[model samples]
Target chain A: MKKLKLTIAVTGLNNTDNPGPGIPVIRGIRESQEIESRIIGLAYENLEPGIYMPLMIDKTYMIPYPSSGTDAYMERIEEINQKDPIDLIIPNLDAELYTFMKAEPRLRELGIKTFLPTMEQFEERHKANLVAYGKKYDIKVPKSSTITSHNDIRKIKNDFDYPVLVKGKFYDAYIAYNEDQVTNHYNKISAKWGLPIIIQEFVKGTEVNVVALGDGLGNTIAAVPMRKLFITDKGKAWSGITLNDEEMIRITNDLIAETKWRGGMELEMIKTNKNDYYMIEINPRIPAWVYLAVGAGQNIPEALVKLAMGEHVAPYHDYQVGKMFIRYSMDMLGDIQEFEQLSIFGEIEQSQLHYPNTQKI
Target chain B: MKLKKNIAVSENGFLFDPNSGESYSLNKTGQLIVKLISEGKSEAEIIENIMEKYDVESNALQRYLDDFIMMLQQMNLLQKEED
Candidate 1:
């Protein structure tokens, strides 16, 4: 029953047209009534807006990009740990997760802990692997194929119709109405995000998502289903409201039980006109829309931290339905000097920035 | 040749078009290019300016600029060429 104090590190701080989950995750941590904490932001770029949000991030250090390999990234983390011993870290980016998962052992040796999916659990849920994953678990997933060449895009017509979804490995998805559009998206996404690109059967229905956390032992700690009220042209949920969908929750629990999934996950599912749910994609971390779950009553980040600390956490049974999260963008005023400091020195202290908490944001 | 009419640009690189009610966030380089484009700088003029300011090679910058302008066209933020 005692209040716990902890220091947490979080990545994926790029909250932009396309967002990373860090800011909302940090907000969830700050809202925790049971845990008092200081935030240490792990950023890949100096310009990640969270690096400038002083109240949300007490201090920040730049880490090498995942493409730089986990060795360099872990070395940067070690350097950060030497300055401030991190109690736990929540890796929020899909691109960077494999590195973090591979480094989990070394981090634990340095007294840093994390709650993440096992490498097996992580790999099986990948876009390329999801069809087999769904079949093994008896869940209905849209028919999909992973293609490494442009020729594969042409062949997709044999299995899928026009308007199939073409997706990148780490990001970007486009609904290609014809083969030419598919080729366009294929070239664009492959150039930026690399292969193998995913071409999924278009499941017609309302798109919905579930943000849930699992306890590694097949128990779901928290689950919240949401429907987007407004979708950006980029296909991000600009405004979304929570739903108390029992079937969505059941699918979430079933997937967690079957995979023994650990840590935070978002299930991007499409409910068909016939009311069938076709799992589309499984993101292995808390979604950018996670603040919705925190606001809806379950503080997933807080509970995830506790689970990482090897503490007992009970499954959340109920949350208020119809909670809405409407996202907005605000300019964060930063001085040239602050940018200079972060860019030149690769580190910045909160005290030096003189930035306002502006919780109003 | 210019940013769409009534487009609002911010120093932080957030772009809003009052015409379409669409919002976009651009990186630092994107902001610079868009600003140059809106200032009536020709493509070559923008490239020459950026080459002097940034370390990127002219050829690579040219390729990137072309890609970015294509993106602008795709977003319908560019005015239609007067036929």
Candidate 2:
């Protein structure tokens, strides 16, 4: 084997952890030789010829820090294609995924391969349209509405209470208890971010997130169900446990089938007291916690990466079930301050961890 | 902050939102924040506690917290009443 030379266009080099959790799927695939990874973040420099660094595989790569818009963004992908053949262009962050999806046709014409759902299906899955999807699927999703003004949120607050949530169509979600709090949050977020916003009903229930890797043809190849064993201040799943969630598993299959969905997709669902899992929102791009799925067993990142490189991967395989993950760094203090955070997940009967292993921690 | 909430967060740091009835994975910093938040620590309070104890900058930590805290508010994890 010539060691399949595959190039991954990632968000950025931003971490010190050898194979940080952000893109663990890629790490899992390159397990033997550590495939080549080129990261482009909010601060990549254009001067350096993004060759593989010494820390990374020998293949050289560029780190184009600030990817501006369609033109410059497309240029980076195009440049790679012009040089050595680029294998896969995986958009990890929300902004990049949205932009890449919008400019998909152009990128394809230029001979760059990528994996993502169509723009129509993509729009249907965002937080802004979650309610509409609930209605479409006849599943009890949250009462979702767009917030163009303070008055829009007031309508929900007056009827509801302080436990209202404001969600970004992209990669952000905020839980505000009062009308004033939401207004302040909306102003701060709207003026500086990428897209519009959506406000959701505060349903009291259990939160479950399901991730599935689908072939571009609407066929789901693999699925992973996890419970948040730990979380960040912003409600990010800090640590989690993989489990055999039948209902969640069914909801996922049912969702993509209804949408005739394709490409890789992730769903955020909240099951209420009645045990009804109300579909919350969707992230079309790769979720940051993908490492857990890889660590558990199924290496979707490698599969997706291989697929992008036009490789014929094997049929889907079930990953390591019941695995748990914990992120490091300063923010981890939030996990400590908030002990009840991981108390929600009652399903995980077993777990798995990286590095120092769970025995010591 | 009591451990009475439905969300099952593990010791090694796994958070399950039994409220939403869904499970998720987190990193170490994320584990700490969720643990603290679940323990009922306020945002400023969490920030103050974390800053004094860690090597990360305050602004960066706050920025990273921007999303999860908002999620806490949205999911009712932060509570509707102001402390």
**Chain B alone, TM-score of each model?**
0.94, 0.70
TM-score of 2: 0.66
True contacts kept of each: 0.00, 0.06
Candidate 2 regions off by >4 Å? A1-4, A12-22, A32-67, A155-161, A309-317, A330-361, B1-83
Which one is best on TM-score? 1
Cα-based lDDT at residue A76, candidate 1: 90
Counted clashes in each candidate structure = 0, 86
Score residue A18 of candidate 2 by CA lDDT. Answer: 25
Q: Residue A35: error of model 2 in Å?
A: 7.7
CAPRI quality band, candidate 2: incorrect
User: What TM-score does chain A reach in every model?
Assistant: 0.97, 0.77
The digit string of per-residue lDDT tens for model 2 on A28-122 reads 55563434554321214321111112223223234332347678766766765675455556665565666778887887787667887888888
Candidate 2 global CA lDDT score: 0.62
Clashing pairs in 1: none
Question: Compared with the real two-chain complex, what DockQ does model 1 have?
Answer: 0.01
